[model samples]
Target: MQITKLELHTSCLQQQRKFYHEVLELPIVEENQNSFTVKTGTTALVFSQAPNTSSNPFYHFAFNIPHNQFAAAKAWLASRTMVINTNGKEDYHFEAWNAHAFYFLDPQQNIVEFIARHNLSNESNAPFSSESILSVSEIGLPVRSVSTTCEYLKQNLSINTWQSYEDVFAAMGDENGLFILNYIERPWIPIAATPGIFPTTISLVGDFTEFTLEDAMYKIVPTAK
Candidate 1:
């Protein structure tokens, strides 16, 4: 599956626009007084201004970078801002997934990750930059029950757990894209310490028929083609 678009709420719209358009160097495809959209490879990430009463909304998401550009991409990001450190490490290697990743926080305190999955031949000869980002690879969905969400996905979308599964955590979908279902209030996997669950919307494409899932805090719409 491929994430075509992701909609998020932010209390700081202008700061987010600057961070993504100027700091991250992503092009703003659409903008207005209330929101802005940035082109991130195959995904269009949209951030709308939240209501005054809304809490400081945040989420966790990952970008798929070229397999061979991990170091360059990390350096590129580190040059602009501090790379998040967890357990005294600035990067991570998922041996089972054959991937390496590093994280940083945006102005909205979102745990943004740049990951390179060596299992895929998405290597590039061009220099590493924001353009090297392939797409939004993963989205963390904070649900009350991981098994319930995973089961719903399995029965409806026919997607199974990619690699890991537990009562509190389950990764659905495959390497190209995944829905990381975490138990509510579970801290995201990063130094951000942000809660996993939030009000989020994701629009994606896949091989199966179109479908939609809605809950109190999350919504997923998939377009089949």
Candidate 2:
């Protein structure tokens, strides 16, 4: 699956905007008083100010980087922001996924990732930069029951599980894009903090129809080709 756009809520709209537009050097394609859209390669990432609530909403999402640019991308991001350390390690090698990834937290403490899938043929000879980001590769979907959610998506969308599935976690879609279904209260990958499963809107190129998830916290829309 290929994610074309993702809409997420943010308590710190201006700060998040500056982080993406200035710190990461992504181009802002649209903006307003309440929200702004930034183009991260092919995916349009939209962040709108969330309504007042007791707790601030955050999320976990990832960008696909060139297979051969992991080191450069890590260095580039580390220089701009602090790369999250996992068990004293800054980068990780996922043997099962055949990918290397690093994590960071945005101003709102949203977990962000830059992942390089070695299995893909998207190696580049050019220097690594913000422009080298290919697309939005992953978005975390925290659910009460991973198995139930996985079944629902498979039945409704005709999407297959990427690799494996367990009671607590399952990855839906292909390497180009994925919906990471994680059990609620489960800490996100490479991080031990409480998970953030805020309201999200995902637009993608896929085979299924558009529908809202259980609690209306998520809206998945498949665009026409």
Candidate 3:
């Protein structure tokens, strides 16, 4: 599945606009006083300013990059901002998954990642830029029950877990797009932040069907040709 758009909340909109537009160099597609949308390659990230009474829970998400541009992408990011290191390692290679990734934090302290799935055929010789970003492919969804959430997604959306441990974590969907479901209080990898459930909405492409995971209440809207 391809994530066409994702709507998330943030406590500070101005800072987010600067981080995404100036630092990441993602073009703004739309903007208003309360919210704005930026183009992350094929995906549109919409950030809404949260209310004062609400807690703006941070998130973890990944962007797909051309496998061939992994090194260049890392260098490009490092030159612009600090690349996060986990256990003194900045880059990570998952041999079983045939993927390489690096992480960083956004203005909202959200864990952001650029993941290259070598198993896929995405390759490029051109210099890596914001254009090299394929899409917002993975989103961390904190749930109370990993198994129940995975089962709901499998039955309702026809998506299965790509990787998981019964009570801990589950990566659902294919390499192109995934929902990282984890039990609350579990710390996100490469960082020490505890996972928390927040309002989120995702739009998927290829099949025009939509559903919402009641437990997490994440709306999944699909679009088709």
- Predicted model with the maximum TM-score: 2
Q: What are the runs in model 1 whose C-alpha is more than 4 Å off?
A: 192-196, 207-214
Provide the lowest-lDDT 10-residue window in model 3. 207-216
TM-score of each model, paired residue for residue: 0.93, 0.96, 0.94
RMSD of each: 1.9, 1.2, 1.6
Sort all candidates by TM-score, best to worst: 2, 3, 1
Q: What tens-digit string does per-residue lDDT give for candidate 3 at 1-225?
A: 788899999998899999899998999999999999999988899999987525866899999999988899999998888899877899989887899999999888899999999999989988999888999999999888889888888877787779887688899999999999988878998887888778899988755467777455588887652
The whole-model lDDT of each prediction reads 0.84, 0.90, 0.88
lDDT of 2 at 173: 93
Kindly give the number of clashing pairs for every candidate.
0, 0, 0
For candidate 2, what is the lDDT? 0.90
Off by over 4 Å in 2: none
Task: Please provide, for model 1 over 77-174, each residue's C-alpha lDDT reduced to its tens digit, 9 standing for 90 to 100.
Answer: 98999899878998899998899999999998998999999989899999998898889989987777788778888986777898765587888988
Off by over 4 Å in 3: 206-209, 214-216
